[model samples]
Target: MSNGWNHTAKIESLSFECGFCNNKVASDIGFFNNNNIDGLRARIRICPHCSKPTFFLGSKKLPDISPGNDVKSVPEEVHALYQEARNCISISAYTASVLISRKLLMNIAVSQGAKENLRFIEYVDFLAENGFVPPNGRGWVDHIRKKGNEATHEISLMDRDDATELVTFSEMLLKFIFEFPASVPALPSA
Candidate 1:
C-alpha cells in the first residue's frame, strides 16, 4: 500500500484550503527546488488546520560553489606593487621607488612563505637565493633602506639624480620579483 506522502518528489507548487469557509484557497506561497542525488526537495510551509498546502514561497537551488584556481595563481597584489614602483620610477622619485620596491619584494616574499617581521638582511638573502636580485644588489637594497630611513627620520636633502637611480634600481627589482615565480620551483619543506 503506497501512502500519499510515501514518494519523495519535488513539490512543484501548493495551494490552501480554508477550514471556516470550506473553500479551496490558492496560496501565493513559493517553493524552491533542492536538487540533490536522491531527488528534488522543496522548501515550503503548509497550513496545519485544514491540512491544505498554502503559499508558493520562493525556493533556492543548492549552489555548486568551489574555491577558484586563482588562489594558487600568482598574487595580483604583487602587480599593484609593481605599478606603484613603476609610477614612482617614472616621476624620477628613485628613493620612493626603492621603498616601494622593497615593499613589493616583502609582499612577494611573504606570499612565497616567508615569516612575518622578516629582517631586511633576511629579505635580501631570500631575494638573492631566489635569483630575484643580484648578490651585489645588497648594497642597493641597503642604500634604499637607508635612504628611506633618512627620508623618514633625518632632515637630509634628497637629490634628483639619487632619486633617479633609486627608481632604476626599483624597476629592476620589481621586474625580478614579478618574473621570478615562473623560473623558481615550488617552496620545499623548511
Candidate 2:
C-alpha cells in the first residue's frame, strides 16, 4: 500500500495513547526511508482522532519539580497521580484531569490514615474529620468531587476552566498537607 510519502510498502496501523483526549487510537503511519537508507520505518506520529502529534517514545522520565517545593515530601503514589493529572490538564484532557484530581484527593486521605473501602464522599468526610484538609478546603474539595462525579457517572466532559480550578485546588491540598508542615523549624529545648 502507498501513503502520504508516496512509497510502496506494507503499512500497518499502530495503536496510540493520545494525551489530548486521553483515549487510545489506531493510526496508519506513512513509511519513510531510514537515515542511511539502511532500512525503512513508518512515521505516523500524529493522532488521527485529535490531530495532535504523538511521540514514538522509547522511555518516559518523571517531570522535574523544584527541590524546595512541597512536592518532595508528598507520598510517591499521590505525587505520581497528581503529576499525571497535571499532564492530562496540559494536554486538554479535562475529563481525565478531573477524574485524576479526585483520585489524588483519595490518595491523600488514605496516606493520612483514612480508612479503606470507603466511597469518595466518605473519603472527603474522613479527610475533614482527621484534619488532613483544612476547613477552607472543603468547598473546593466538594467542587472537585461533584465535577469528578459528573465526569465519572455521567456522559460529560469538563472544560479547561473547570479542570484548571480543580487542579489548582489539588495543588493547594498537596502543599497544605505536605509542604506547610515541613517548613517549620524545630524549637530549641529550654
Best by lDDT: 2
lDDT tens string, model 1, 4-50? 13233344444444422234444434343444323535444343344
Number of clashes recorded per candidate? 10, 0
For all predicted structures, in order, the TM-scores are 0.44, 0.63
lDDT of 2 by residue, 53-134 (tens): 5543233211211111226578899989888877776555779988988888888888999888889899988888788777
- Checking candidate 2 for backbone clashes, the offending pairs are none
**Cα lDDT of model 1 overall?**
0.53
lDDT of each: 0.53, 0.71
| Cα misplacement distance, residue 109 of candidate 2 (Å) | 0.4
